[model samples]
Target chain A: MSLAERMLKIDRRIIFLVIGLCTLLPLLYPVGLPIRISSEVRGVYDHMESLPERSVFLLSIDFDPASKPELHPQAIALLRHAFRKDLRVIAMTLWVSGTGMAEQLVTQVAKEMGKEYGKDYAFLGWSPGGQAVIINMGQDLYSAFPSDYGGKPTKDLPVLDGVRNLKDVAYMVSLGAGRPGVEEWYVFGKDKYKFELGGGCTGVMAPGLYPLLRSGQINGLIGGLRGAAEYESLIGQKGKAVAGMDAQSATHLAIIVLVIICNVFYLSLQRAARTQRQIG
Target chain B: MDATILGAWVATGLTLLIFSFLYKDNPLFKLAEHLYVGVSVGYTIVKAYDTVIVHLVIKPIIENGEFALLIPVAIGMLMLTRYVPKAAWMSRYAFAFIVGMGAGLAIPRTISSFILKQIEDTVRPVLSLAGPDGVTFSMNRLSIAGLGKGWHEPASSFS
Candidate 1:
């Protein structure tokens, strides 16, 4: 077969193996590339920074295990920022599977920063009725989340003293995997309630939300692990996000190189075929 | 001695067994899948009842007395009417009301959040060299911000 034809017929398994190695190498080794922090990431950091000490902010973990790698770091970094600034955080989840994970992370990060539960932070846990729950929260937080994630009444929590509805919230941020995420919050929670809104989403959903970010529907967005890394940089903390960046950068470059090589080989095959046909 | 710990171990074993299907399909995957669906349905039903009793029925009545409960009670009955073919059309009104209220509640918020707020942020100028005393100026313009503009006039000062 001609070189072009051969290129077209290249086995896909080879590509997969190449891509897998590209992704794995940086993960195993260590190289720190200079990361340019996008305006979107800076916006989120700035928003959190601008909050007064002890101000209440709502952080929703609306994802599950499948999205942990991309989103967990975001949750950790944001919580660190909030706690470091002495901001009061109220963490919760709308997804059932996310409840335990969110709860665990919230407690862990809060403990690391010496934040007292019910004093510096509170968790409302998970509830059913996706958008309905948001609307209920807008109208009255107590009505929707009558109790803490652990089943204690929210009204009694020192962290939530005087918080009634979304009005009292300084900002609402959700680390989302899919539906019932930033979109739902923008529609039901932030609209009538009038709180500043932001999100951290997996890469696939990031580009589509840019229009919203451009227009300010979301004040800022942290997209994928790159975003998590940028956030870590801003906080001066080099954790998993920084560690993951090497893998991401290496994998992307490897994919690009492979594409170029495949194309060159393909053209060579085509040229050889044409020369043979002319001679014959 | 404890049922919870025993249940946890059982769950752990089942999870490992189910994940083993990633290597190849087997009876274990099927069993796990069925158990997952069954447990999920049961949980959903119980949760539904809890929501209904608390949000739709008991709490409203407790807060606002019997009169407050009637409207939602009627809606609940309207939902039930879906089973009767003759009364199916009436259920549309209930659905319509629910959908309409949701949309009505959403549109204004959407306008403010997704529209107005975003415009306000993006339209700001990228450079302003003003200092605290208004005499000292700083020039740290980013090329990324000035991509399309020439570096001369204030209006054209980005690129």
Candidate 2:
């Protein structure tokens, strides 16, 4: 068989192996590449920085384990920022599948921050209705969540003092994977209640939310692991997102190289075919 | 020996097993897939029951004396009628009420939030020259034209 033909017939396993190596090597070794911060990510960082101490920051963890790689770091970074600023955080989840993960994450971060539960933070966990929960919270927080994830009455939580409804929140962000997420928050929580809002979503959902961000319905957005890495940098805490960037960059470069090689071989094969035809 | 460590090891094994599908699907991959789905569904049910039944329903009604909640409770109970062969038809009343109430609540909110507010934002002036002082460029003027011919030169040259 000709070289072009043989190349075309290359086993799919070889491609997978190359990709695996490309991802694994950089992760094992270290190439510290600088991550450029986009304005969207910076917008979130700046707003969080500008918040006064004790400002009510509502964080909606609206994703499950499937999105853990991307959204988890975003949550951690945001928690770091909020706690660093001494912001009173109210965390909740719309997805039932995500409730445990959100609860664990909030607890872990709060412990790291040495922040007390009732004073510094409260987790309202998952509720039954998606948008209904949000709407109910807007009207009255205590009615929607009588008791938080830990079974403490939200009304009595010192952290929730003066925070009666969604409108009482100074700022909010939803790290969402799907529906009952950022869109639901905007529609049911922020738009009518008139709270400042931001968003963090998996990369797949990021482009779709840009219009909302541009329209100022969402004040800022953190998109995917890259956004998480940027936020981590902004907070001066290098975590899983930062560690994974090397692998991501390497895999991206490998794919780019493979595409270039494939195109080159394709052009050469086409040229050879044309020359043979002319000779015939 | 610790439970957390054991859990971590299991998680690592499952992750590797799932990743094995990259080579080709096998029994290991299938095992991991089924385990993941089973665990997720089981966890979701448990969480939903905790949040919906224990916290939202029983706690409020019993502790807080929220008797008005029985309206929703009764409607929810009507949905359980679907499991009965003869009473299955009765579930339609519950469904109808839910649909009607959902529509009543969502329609106006959806219109205002998704449509009207978006239109309001979109219809605003794209470029406004009006500033606090006068009609100066209200936006940042960091144009490529402002960067002269030597803009591409290294900073070392300027130094």
The candidate that wins on TM-score is: 2
- Listed per candidate, the RMSD to the true structure in angstroms reads 8.7, 10.1
Q: How do the residues A192-235 of candidate 2 rate in per-residue lDDT, one tens digit apiece?
A: 68888999999889999988888778888999999999999988
Per-candidate iRMS values, in order, are 7.7, 10.2
User: Per-residue alpha-carbon lDDT of model 2 for B91-142, expressed as tens digits?
Assistant: 9999999899889777767766666556645544432332222211111221
Error of model 2, residue A185, in angstroms: 0.8
Off by over 4 Å in 1: A1-7, A129-132, A269-280, B1-87, B115-159
lDDT of candidate 2?
0.86
Q: What tens digits encode model 1's per-residue C-alpha lDDT throughout A1-280? A: 6556766787776666677677778788878888899999999999999999989889999997669889999999999999999998999888776776788899999999998888999988877778788889988999888777666878899899888888889988988899789888887776556789999999888997888787566899999999999999999987898899998888888888878987888778778879999999
Q: What DockQ does each candidate score versus the true complex, computed on alpha carbons?
A: 0.21, 0.32
Misplaced by over 4 Å in model 2 are A270-280, B126-159
